[model samples]
Target: MAGPNIKHAAYHGPSIMKEIFFGISLSLMAGYLWKRHHWNIQRRTREFYGLLDRGEISVVVEDD
Candidate 1:
């Protein structure tokens, strides 16, 4: 025969699992978006600098 407290504990387990699962899901999504944005900006910067190095583009730095 099971006690009343044991039944409540059993029901709470799945609710905890659901919360953990959603938390991980949100974290992974945020990480992926951050990585993607960083990669794109780095790529563009490199390409622009590469073009400048080749004398195909001119850069003017203003004196402060």
Candidate 2:
């Protein structure tokens, strides 16, 4: 039931190296993006607080 001259399909080959490379690259990119976003949010929050402290903005509450 086994053939001695069977060839592997074009879509079926060794791709371990490629997979690992892409996986690492994509993860690194995602991590970079996440960190950048976190830093931006932190900076915005700090700026908002600073503005509030300097009286640049105010919080008003309305009772209904």
Query: Which candidate ranks first by lDDT, i.e. highest?
Result: 2
Q: Worst 10-residue stretch by lDDT in candidate 1?
A: 5-14
Off by over 4 Å in 1: 1-14, 61-64
lDDT of 1 by residue, 1-64 (tens): 9657653334434587889999999999999999999999999999999999998888887589
Clashes in predicted model 2: 0
Per-residue error for 6 in candidate 1, Å, reads 26
Per-prediction backbone clash count: 0, 0
Measured by TM-score, how close is model 2 to the native structure?
0.69
List the global CA lDDT of all models: 0.89, 0.93
